[model samples]
Target chain A: MADQKEEVKLLGIWASPFSRRIEMALKLKGIPYDYVEEILEHKSPLLLALNPIHKKVPVLVHNGKTVVESQVILEYIDETWKHNPILPQDPYERSKARFFAKLVDEQIIGVGFGAMAKADEKGREVLAEQTRELLMYLEKELVGKDFFGGKSVGFLDLVAGSMIPFCLERGWEGLGLEVVTEEKFPEYMRWVKNLEKVEFVKDCIPPREKHVEHMNYMVERIRSS
Target chain B: MADQKEEVKLLGIWASPFSRRIEMALKLKGIPYDYVEEILEHKSPLLLALNPIHKKVPVLVHNGKTVVESQVILEYIDETWKHNPILPQDPYERSKARFFAKLVDEQIIGVGFGAMAKADEKGREVLAEQTRELLMYLEKELVGKDFFGGKSVGFLDLVAGSMIPFCLERGWEGLGLEVVTEEKFPEYMRWVKNLEKVEFVKDCIPPREKHVEHMNYMVERIRSS
Candidate 1:
């Protein structure tokens, strides 16, 4: 149901997990919106104007006002529309979902990207530690649940699982880390499969080889310089 | 209104900025909640049980169920009890507010703490850069507005303003940073003063000396080791 009162537009970067989260949320809500793919390296002046502070993307522009940040966009979407609620009805359940979602934002998204972006031995070490910690926490938390939010794919699942294939392709799996081993994180692995199967997610994800090559190049550049 | 059906208990540490956001939200909502002071360093089993992954405060336990993360807790409170709503009525405004709030959480909270926690010169440099970026954004965005949400304090105000006095007291001002100078961030400074005057906020905030001492110790520890 596209409302005539306001036009919905999304300013995003293709490979950004943050952008991916907003895209999935919008799609799941069945909200039709225009998408503007921003070249993050050479950011658009419009993107800068919309998000001057962070200058990062997945910005959702509705009726001219721009909303930056993925989780916030998710909340805005949930509140704006009633259909296909991403958050849980139960307050506590909603909080837990949001907490884990924040965890993914802080730990996984932050460190995972940091690891790929930095090539220095010290930075890599820090990234490795952070990554290991995040995976360990994920392994423990996702033990029984099919997704982080339980049976149905909810906010936590969408936010946390969005980064999985990207992280795997970025050599997170090849980092000699045991955080997501089959024996330890069986449910997490299953959740990864489930996330990969989602149509919108499948369609939206960038090629793994490109991401890997970019990450490797970045890492090498950091290490050498 | 303390309804038996909606029993609310807040598990929090006295000095945590994150926990203070929830406390402010609950107070602003006029919702009477049972306050449980949690020792974060030696987390109680109950805290672990409530939030196994993060094992942190403030955890809002409602009717035997728990909600963690301050931002999520604010949303839950707003949803559960619609009185004095923390978010905006307009969808676009709500999204903008939430986006800025998330920015405060991600950039300010993360990088601010990093500055205080790290001892190395390089770490401090990184922290300085991030802090400057966040503050500069805040300064520009907050121009002419009494609060981020405008007119009256809202979710963004509570979340963003919570850090000000703490940061100021913990050597942010002493560091002679250009980002949050009085000339640059007049609105932010005014907002900080207003927040400090609030009874609930005044009661909840830790003493300046304690914060300064703790931060100094952390910095020294990081440097020495």
Candidate 2:
């Protein structure tokens, strides 16, 4: 256990919200870990070996054992560390938090990427509709609460908040869609602003232009094709 | 707590894999609760009141408090109960399990439903391709393991396996596609067979004819539209 504490390392990409999820979780838990930024385009042998199935970022290596996937990593961090608990101790609340987190990951993240990569008007419309539906759900469910779980930041906030700036930079701003406007989604806007103040999150997020350029390139590719 | 446990009840639709995910988790945890099957086509007033946003099936009520979403309900059940734990204690393993489970839920389930709801060549091809990808990842990651977490049927297995019969019925037989052939996905097939044999699962899962009929109707509607 003593040796385990000293060997925590995170393999991630600079601009990835998924990677930031693990990063924020570790920071929130006050665990010290070595951060390794992987060049996702180049594909590192170590990254491939660590996450053969997905070969994606945000792989946590502890005592030589590796765990991939950001949502999974958040849970692992909460379970591994007892202090500064990110997940609620009560089962029902924990479930609600996780389910909301999964909703963000599955519906919001999935549809956001789909919208970014889509070229056709119909495809874009489908993605937009899905995104709107998600936003509406969030607006209704998360109203009057500072975080999804209320008061202090918890797992859902960490996962959902980490993606906001990136999604705004990439999906919403890049596509010129007013999916999450201040007028329509005041609560989400408040939540996003609150998340930006967190120290680790401020430090770990990628430069806004990088995400914009990347998304612009994708949109251009879709248009040309 | 005892009074709270007594008031717990599950509002579910029998054919839904999502509902089954909750049922299986509760059964595994040895929790005693009343189960009410909701008719989804004409959603009961109770169901609508419990889950106004999605108005979806598999809503769990504990002491008159409702928790919607099957994955959310599963986590709630696991946390509420002490015996027969479904999720791993270690953070890393839990994350890996969750990531895979989410992948299954979002990708596999999404594609599976798509396959069922369309009769066109493009739809079938997309479904086949996605199913193959999901099975490939599962086979590679879950090789030699009895369940996703090695020996016991944890959260991953419950979430992933909940959809097997639906896939086999709609994906394999109804679509006339060999999505999980014996040679291509031997391990997945074996796992599905093993999961089906569980006593609670066997009792809870609806007969194949019902799912096939619903899927065929969906396909007709999609094609006509």
- Best-fitting candidate, measured by TM-score? 2
| RMSD, every candidate, angstroms | 4.2, 3.9
lDDT string for model 1 (B37-132, tens) is 988469999899988767889899878777877888888888788878788888777877777777777667767766655656576668867776
Per-residue alpha-carbon lDDT of model 2 for B100-143, expressed as tens digits?
A: 88778767777766765666778787777777887788887768
Worst 10 residues of 2 chain A by lDDT: A163-172
Q: Rate the local accuracy (lDDT) of all candidates.
A: 0.73, 0.75
Candidate 1 chain B weakest ten by summed lDDT: B171-180
Q: Candidate 1 local accuracy as lDDT?
A: 0.73
Runs with alpha carbons beyond 4 Å of true place in candidate 1 = A4-6, A110-133, A136-152, A173-181, A208-211, A221-225, B4-7, B39-41, B110-133, B140-145, B173-182, B207-225
Residue A8 shift from truth in candidate 2, angstroms: 2.8
- How many pairs of residues collide in model 2? 2
Q: B165, model 2: CA deviation in Å?
A: 3.4
